[model samples]
Target: MKMAPKGNDVIVSDRKLEMILSMKGGNGEASYANNSQAQAIHAQSMLHLLRETLDNIQLMEPPSETIPFALADLGCSCGNNTLYIVDVIIKHISKRYEASGYEPPEFSAFFSDLPSNDFNTLFQLLPPIGSSMEECLASDTHRSYFAAGVPGSFYRRLFPTRSIDFFHSAFSLHWLSQVPESALDKRSMAYNKGKVYIHGANEHTANAYKKQFQTDLAAFLGARSKEMKRCGSMFLVCLGRTSADPTDQGGPGILFGTHFQDAWNDLVQEGLITGEKRDSFNIPVYASSLQEFKEVVEANGSFVINKLEVFKGGSPLVVKQPDDAAEVGQALANSCRSVAGVLVDAHIGDQLSEELFKRVERRGSCYAKELIEQLQFFHIVASLSFA
Candidate 1:
């Protein structure tokens, strides 16, 4: 039972400062696009849950004239995944219109992410206006499709009041707006020493993470509340823990953190990075339990959960037939590096990330075979309607 942080000595920021928490952009070797197969799988799973909610929107009485339907994908990184999601949504909506004998409303899609995200790459990958529609909707319906990038943190309001009709986000909300202040404050009991995240950390460290998540999640819901129209629905999919216990270490959180720790430890041993640097660093990610997610949504009193589920995620690192440890290890390392390289580089210097991940690949090779066996990775999908 670790003691909680004393008083309010932790320096909490009033303003939600924009920081560089996005994945490596573009289609480069280390880019998120190349390493986001697992995320793409999660997105595909979420589409099944979104069909009903989207049908509900079409069920609403047809408005006078073709009112432009607005859809926003929050935390849309630079990749074809977001475009693929957008296409799916548009295709489903078109099908609903066709069934009801109603003309499909023109689409006004917004792809949003932190300012640092590669909008250039995203736009480049976006199918030409008529191309995507031709493949799904009938060519006769001259339903114009428009897309634009919204750059900023989703923890704050990004769209106008009551503008969004549908909102979707995948594999993003698990990230907190910022690292917990207590984890960085040396005087705080919640200081997370010698860990990049709250893996095997103390109870206080976990509490610190939980508190930050609650705040950020509230802010997220509040912002969306203002932007979403009445009866509008949001689909969110992200990593989550099954158990309420934060110290269980039975999930992806611990597995990934342990891999990073092992890599960092090797660096320390090699005199590449100092032990003190490793002690002070903590990744700004928290995987919440289903109960906690419900609590936050209910506490917000704005959105009602239409659907909530937890499902195991298939590991992208596994290979069929003869499994080569080296190949498997490198695949796992690349996946982790693509998403976390930015944060790791910021703290430990960009010069060492390549070498550090190489060590991680080598160290993680032995356990690569067991990656797919663990039932730790969970995909939490929730469909929420504005109440």
Candidate 2:
């Protein structure tokens, strides 16, 4: 893999970043739109939690009558998922102003992602302002909603200071700004061997992954702190592990890691990919524990935790049992391929992705019966207010 310098000293390669940004877009079979049902469900579950915060923002008196409610969704991928979130916010804010007998402020919602995201596809899917609402509030009728796509990585500043009133991110922050340098360095103690991530790795390798997550998360919080108005709130939902030990084989990372390792081993036996290539490749994801998440937020000191909760195994958001093994496997395969296909393709070459996913789908089918009973995944939903 080629390594290129980028960001604030983060050693991400230009090709890797480009592959991640540009590969998943549009509404094609491989697009995130078709594969992100679980993510959409998680985003829906957060709507109730966000209601109070949206109301509180409406209660605040704006410095001027014309300043619109500036809202943003970081890592807004191409789909109706983001539009669904925006609609929820618009509904709550409009109702609050109507109940208070005040004219509602206009909305300016920014959808942000890496530069290669399919903004064209996103705009085409978005319903015109009030079109999707069941009953448009009187305030909504008078006020217009302006939407724009702001292309950039959220690991750095993407907006002017104090410009945003509210922000959201879903299923995106778990990815580090870049892979840990030590993991890729042959001389380093953290050099991961024969596995893509820290799963089944030594203490040194695990800690290296943790350190990178901390650095990236801190940068994320710091940038948002500068961009948001005082008292502004952000709701973030991302993959998390129940275990404090990074090496524990208990989370979705382990599940995916096991499957990928098994698949690669089969491919190697068939002489499809070299052993060195398998050893060098690692997925740039870390499912942080609740404690780890709290530590990062507290250390940053820019936001106060309003609500911090974890939905563990068997949670509605994590487990959705399907009717049959084939259906279950196909759904899981679609979701995994949509997000991870780019990385896998980049590592081994795009020629093998279809065959790789086919093997993955077969393995996934065997687990359908088990998944029907329970799922081992968890999610951390955090609601924070600027301090």
Candidate 3:
């Protein structure tokens, strides 16, 4: 058994980790593709905003078929969530074109994510483009559109300037390009000592995370602005801090046993890995507060905020039935694993990652009923357009 060693001076750099990080792929039980209902649900709630954007966006000079309507889903995880949004956009625009007594424009939809994302699965889930809405419904497929995969980071430009008529992302933009350098530097005072995330960490550690998020968001908005048409808009939803409180995870506070830190702490106590080694590893995600998010977008100055709201989001992993309480822990663990297992594996090894999550699952199951029944989180839903 290869236990991770703390003696190594250099860990895998954050840039390398970022390149390889992606949601668990494939259709297995643990795959992000299967476990991403929470994300899809988040998108569903933003349909009103999406519809509003579609109504306002003018893509073609006369809305002709020759000028295909172009839209891109940034950070499109390996799930049907992107497809769902793409379908909605296509349907909405097609209806408008038909009402104007014009031939409905051909649609171009791009699914984008990191190079390591489960894009193969995402592509497989796509239906034949240009199918009628009724045909799509009959086959349990999505709406009509030409589907293309754009493989790269969204932090940089992925489309030609002023080409995309609509941009959509959901539950994805909080990921930083890299974890803060200070958080991983043991010699630095801001080194995250005990926690795997900034949630409940010291002020220095929390600030480091917040700064990184702001930087990445600036780059993201900058890139999107170049690609968006003058009248185009973006609709986004992301998991975020519910309040001004730094430790806030939604409203109920973070679950004790189900968090990544609990599992890491258990491993450290068992001497499977040194505390120093644990300190070196941190998940590169931030749940930005709405105020913090708006500050960045405002600072960027490329886009004007159209709609922004924070609301409580429900989790399917919550324990609803008395008979099913036992499964809550496993569900919670699976949810976390699906989103981050790859990063964990890269930081530690596959074996250590498995054991760590096992401890989390076991502990979570034992404390299932004691945990919050709602497991609600706050989602920041926003719509923005070029300034």
The model with the greatest TM-score is: 3
Clash tally for model 2 = 2
lDDT order of candidates, best first?
A: 3, 1, 2
lDDT of 2 at 286: 83
Root-mean-square deviation per candidate: 6.0, 4.8, 3.0
Listed per model in order, the count of residue pairs whose N, CA or C atoms clash below 3 Å is 0, 2, 0
The candidate that wins on lDDT is 3
Instruction: Give one digit per residue, the lDDT tens place, for model 2 in 1-387.
Output: 564332112233456463365436777776787767667776666677778566556345654458877899998988878887877887787677767767667779999988878889888876545642233544334224788999888999999999998998978888777778899788988988777768888899889988998888999999999999885788888778877798863555645676656777666667776666666767777888888999999999999888887865332213344767777666656666777776776556555667777876687688776655554557788889877
lDDT of 3 at 48: 85
Judging by lDDT, tell me the better candidate of 1 and 2.
1
For candidate 1, the per-residue lDDT at 264 reads 82
lDDT of 1 at 41: 74
Question: How does model 1 fare in lDDT?
Answer: 0.76
Model 3, span 273-318: residue lDDT tens:
8888788778787888999999999999998788888866776463
Query: Which ranges in model 3 have alpha carbons more than 4 Å from their true place?
Result: 1-15, 59-63, 130-143, 251-258, 316-323
TM-score of each predicted structure versus truth: 0.90, 0.88, 0.91
- What local lDDT score does residue 156 receive in model 3, on the 0 to 100 scale? 89
> What stretches of model 1 exceed 4 Å from their correct place?
1-17, 58-66, 131-144, 316-322
